[model samples]
Target chain A: MERLLFDLSIAIERGKENETSPYPPDLKGKPGAYEFTSRLLEMNCPPDTILKQGMMPGMDRIGKKFADGIVFIPEILIAAKAMKAAMTLLKPYFDNGAVLRKGKVIIGTVAGDLHDIGKNIVCMVLEGAGWEVFDLGVDVTKEKFLASLNEHPESIICMSALLTTTMREMEKSVTTIKQAFPQTKIYLGGAPLTSDFADKIGADGYFPDPHSLSKHLTGNL
Target chain B: MINKTFRFSTESLLPDISLILIEMGYSIPLADHYLSDLINDTLQQVRKHTRVQAGFIMLPKDSIKTQSNILFENRLLFEPGSIIMSQLQNVTSLAVFLATLGSDFDLWIKFVQQIDMLQAFVIDTIGSLMVEKAVDLLEEQISMQAMIRAEKCTNRFSPGYCQWLVDEQHQLFHLLPADFDWVKLQPSCLMTPLKSISGIIGLGKNVIKIPYHCAFCDNKSCYRRLKNRKGQ
Candidate 1:
């Protein structure tokens, strides 16, 4: 079981979505995360175990590589796409509560920023890490975040911005949410934001990559 | 509220070299026309003998003061406000030398036209790859350095954020080395390199540095904060 899980993780990391998908060119014509994950389910391997051990670890590697600059956006995006493809098979388990989530995270690109690449990457990594992510998408408003929080009181909030102009939206949202719910932890990121900026805005934390964020959340939980 | 810093160094000269290549009519793939204009401006003013070196440092919020100055001499984008201020420091002695190189209006015009042509060709092929590579190199270097220093650095932050006021450009400029004569920050706080970067990094021991969510922050009216908290 462990060996199969490791194989699936390697597939996801290499961006092998399925046997027919041709990516990472070197792995062409080989079974990918999709086939492996489906096979694991057919074999009655628990979905929770598969997600926790297989998909999460693969995402963790991709996130660390991204943070270390060992990989760029294109590579990370491919890995994320592969992970998402595998995730579709497990969605039913999640809905049925057979695969319990670590927690909920509300994520989005703050307002005035149309950029979604970074936000999408984080969302995928967090999902792979076993968190239920409520993606608010680009140009998210504070009201939407608050409403989401109201609906999912246990959810953690994350904000992203690629433009300097939109970074202010991240700060505004953090400040508003913290005031309303002081206990809620907020995570902020993007090309233009720093931990200093996050601190200045009184956010709970700031991380450069999703792997570090996932690890931090996992340890805390 | 964890403060951290990470730094690393690599022997990549691609960014600086690419700048020179663009000046010599070597087309940069995927670059927008405006980027070429920005690069041409730097090429014209840079000294011939000077070389460019760049570094980034992210400080704690309390370490830096935020302030704003009027841009365009009088045109206000909104009420004059302070956004997060980040500094991009470049040492360009050659740039200064090039600036002193006697100006030839005709040559300059022709150079501009060449850059326009290159931009048209490269935008589709490599809009920001060259510049992105440069930033990536610097980021990797700084991150490794920070890690060696035992400080976990978060991602780079630039000016125009919530707490760090864009108006604090002068303060960041103060931290820059005095030797780089070619590059200058205008009243609007724009860097001459056009390819140069300015941002902040948090230095500390913690692994995860949480950012304050703008939606929950009390500074609701911060001009730099994004207006849409929820999706439109």
Candidate 2:
């Protein structure tokens, strides 16, 4: 049973989806995450164990590789793909309180920046790391962020923007939100921002990559 | 926004994952083959579903200045205000433009949600690459047009680059021809295609040579800036 869990982790790390998935050719005909996860559940393995042991570690390994530049976005994407496949079967258990989330986060792209890849990647990494993320979609305004923040006061607020154009919006949103909820910790992520910018914006943290953000979520930041 | 029916050009370039990875600081040889294949597959999927359209209009040089969110035909008015775009003293004209990978890409992203999130991410990255390529193509074509006028073109500068504010995006979009179905801009300046871009290009003789694009920006962790700093 332990070996099966290990196999599940390996399959996820390799991005092998199932027997028919052409990815990682060596695992081509072998059972992928889908098959392994189903089998593990059938074995009466605890849902949390499958997630913590099987998916999280696999995602954690890849997440580290990704942050260190040992892996690229595509590899991260595939790994995320595999992990999500397994997570789908585990969702019911999670919803039923059989498993507990690491924490919760409210994240979005600040208004005027319609980009979402960065947000999507960050959310995926966070969720894989065991956080429940409330994703506020693109062009999200400051009011929207405040609304979500008010509703999920326990959730960390993470804002993202891809363009320098929208940095002002990010700054504006942060300033307003910080003033209104000075106790709420805010984090900023984007392609055109720096730690200095985060400091300037009065943010609690600046995650250079989703891995670091995950670490922050895990209290490692 | 300067309205005009001036001539321009449009083109598209597919994303190259190998090169994209290199930009992300991964040497070509160090790139994972499986990952490369997956990104390429995602690009192909986006390409299959994408309808790319990008074009730029070359407005004749005018007295350009800005005041109260308005360019005085010669003023360097910033979108969010107080950004010196650059030395446009000799900028005889501006190439206002728009580019998009189309709504199909948006539909594809939404569709991928029910399928796979990772693939969706890849597709999203591909769309961004497409928009960049489209802008690159637009700038190149604009440069050629400048050459025909016996003028040199400054490196393309968008509404939010350097000192320009993103708030100026709507102003630039209003200059494109009516019925320009390719891309649409919102009151907030967000483009519809999600992978769309709109900005200005300086065309002239001896327009100020731009310093490295990194000098004026704050995103110190950008891969482009990182690669540039590493002397790549």
Candidate 3:
């Protein structure tokens, strides 16, 4: 079971969606994450086991690879897509509370920024890491962020931006939330944002890559 | 002796330029360094590929300008506007390499070889061309709409340029796509392509028109210009 789980994780990391998927030429014709995930379900493996042992580990490897620069964006996108495919099969279990999420996170690209690539990656990694993410999408306003916060009060907030101008909106949103809820921890991230910039903006934390952010969040929680 | 020749057109790749750069091993932060080398290599390749009196134009600061013209297409939240400026004198250098389309045989062979170098050479060359073309298109578009030469771009200013600070990257984010392929800028205004650029242009008059040689300039804080001078 452990070996099967490990193999599934590798398949997902390599973007092996199924036997028919042609990407990662080396893995052609092999059963992908989709097949193995369904097989696990059919074999009566627990949903939590599949998630903890299969999906999570897969995303973790992909995230680590991204951080180390072994894989580039196209590869990461494929992995994220494969992980998403597997996650769909497990959604029912999560909804039924058989697999409880460790926590919830409110994520979005701040207003004036139409960028979603980084935000989507983080959302995928965070979801694979076992968080129930409330994606606010691109160009989210402060009101939307605050509304989401009100709805999911226990959730942490993550702000994403891809432009120098939109980063200002991130600062504004964080400031607005902190002023209203002093205990609310805000995480800031994006290509242009550094640890120093995060501190300057008064955010709770900053991460260079999605995997690091996932580890940081789960480690503390 | 690097004798390899490569080339690609920028006609269909205005927006996705950064994505191509990432695939070429040029990260956004390291883009400038690779760009300098790419430019040099491209010039050499052009020389070998065709016989044309190819040269580049290094605009002075005084010739560039920044003009802003707002346009409302729909009721979208963003009030779109173009920032036009004269970037003439401020241009550290604008070197262009042109090679006539060579004999069909050499052109075809070189083109195929260029495809193989896409991850290394073609991307940067295309990126440089796109940026230059973008500026030119922007200039022409702004001029046509404004009914005048709006402003001159003093120089191409990117993140971490001189003492301008990298934090300013946030300002440029509002102008670009959030997730441009693998090249996304985070909330902090950092670009993912790792080979992208951001810079400033002083519009209007009173702009300084300095020569290409950095040895004659008094601004000691100019990083790239100073580096070039030292190499000489």
TM-score of each: 0.54, 0.81, 0.60
Instruction: Provide chain B TM-scores across all predictions.
Output: 0.44, 0.78, 0.36
Mind giving the per-residue lDDT tens digits that candidate 2 earns over B79-145?
4333334445466677777777778889998788657765676666666666788777777777778
Q: Relative to the unseen true structure, what is the C-alpha lDDT of residue A101 in candidate 2, on a scale of 0 to 100? A: 94
Off by over 4 Å in 3: B1-133, B136-155, B158-232
10 residues in a row with least lDDT, candidate 1 chain A:
A69-78
TM-score of model 1 (CA atoms): 0.54
Instruction: Judge candidate 3 at residue B183 and give its lDDT.
Output: 37
Model 1 ranges with Cα > 4 A deviation: B1-232
Per residue, candidate 1 scores C-alpha lDDT tens digits across B105-224 of 223333433333222222212213333444556656656655665655444444544545555555555544444445566544544443345544444454343443454233544433
Cα lDDT for residue A175, model 1? Answer: 82
lDDT of 2 by residue, A1-221 (tens): 89989999888888887778877767778899989999999999999999989888888888888888777766776777787778899999989999999878899998877777678878887887888999998889999999888898877899998777677788899998988888888999987788898998789888878988888778743
